[model samples]
Target: MGKMIVRLWRRGFLSALNRGGDPHISDEDLTARARHLAARRHLVAEDGQTELTHALATGLHAATELLEEAGLSRRDARDRAGVAFLKSGQNLARWSMRLWLWVTPDPVGHAKAGNKLAERARMAWGSGLTVHQENGPDHATLMVTECVFVDYFWDAGRSDLTPILCAWDAQWMEIVNASDRPVSISRSGTLAQGCEACDFCFKRKAKLVYSAPFWDRLRGPGHGHG
Candidate 1:
């Protein structure tokens, strides 16, 4: 996972930098940039999930800085970084969701699968997750009161990036629900926005008529869509 993240970050960063007439950024320079951002953000490359998340955050921070160096404003640079990161992982996200749907053939199975995965993730991060699970015949909901990503970014003074991470959840869920046995997620509040908790309600539906425009919206003209 760590190596994959590094590759993703490198690819995304170079892709963004290429737009400014230079794709020849050296690997050493990129690594130095990420290390610099990690230092600025107080992110340590600890073991397990800490290392993974911090690496991603550092890479994203570096990407933003590179974009800014290319003459974009801070806001625009961050926006571009978010889009680049998302686009880089879209294929993986889709494949993972499809595999999950294949393994969990029914609503109950799907809910259980989700719970197991969430538990593993929580254990990996080792902090900042409070989950409540409610399961019914046709639905399952996971109410998260505290999110480690939100806490980590907030403490790092990069809380603005939390929404970009939250948007990935919506994107992945959208991919999952696109399966035959559609399971839709309804989220109202988010810790990123200073809400008490993130209310994620996943319900089984015969036909879910919803489209996630997160990517398109984020890539739009202005940051209004964010």
Candidate 2:
């Protein structure tokens, strides 16, 4: 992650922590915990990762450690980090989604572009992104057919943390499912969740309603964004 992304993620993480954190765990303590995690290079996933994915792996691994050190259960730490990561990336994710939607308005076209994007991403991540069944004008599925992190986390005995990386897509998917967009992305299963793949199902809405633009609708929850 870049300095800016880390800063944003940190901000969001703190906010998420404060909302329902243990009464004993102060904001300063969590901030310091995150800072300590960020201070060093924590190597969790070594191979089959891009610089970005490597950062995600190490960051998740580090957060797992820090949270554990802070007396959180493994599940709570990952879930909490997942939520914070989702909040942190919402802005850019929405904008990229808006731009992608603009370029490929129709669901089928957008699905094709998603395929290309996955292909390009594979060059970096060392795993394939499978965009399946673009034949449907309004429905498609995108998934990590082979996620590199599977092995890394499994080896580290921290596969539970893999879902935190999956959080990167949660915001964009939410945008797709938002009212303004003509499409809907749904994925109830994930590789980290013990599913065969991290599936993101894209479906076009049967009808379009223009109450408020999705961007404007997004502006509220998107506020105080990290």
Please write out the lDDT profile of model 2 over residues 1-226, one tens digit for every residue. Answer: 3445545555665566446565334446654554454344354433444434545554556555666677888788777666655665677788977777654545545565647545545555654234333335556666666675665577667787766667677777777666454677778788777787776677766554422343445567554112
lDDT of 1: 0.66
Candidate 2, number of clashes:
0
TM-score of each: 0.74, 0.63
In candidate 2, stretches whose alpha carbon ends up further than 4 angstroms from where it belongs are 1-49, 123-134, 207-226
User: Please, what are the lDDT tens digits per residue for candidate 1 over residues 109-216?
Assistant: 457565753564476554446776766677766778887678767776778778887887788778765655446667887888878878777776654443223443
Error of 2 at 85 (Å): 2.6
Best candidate per lDDT, number? 1
Candidate 1, run of 10 with poorest lDDT: 207-216
- TM-score top scorer: 1
Which 10 successive residues of model 2 have the least lDDT summed? 126-135
CA-lDDT, candidates in order:
0.66, 0.59
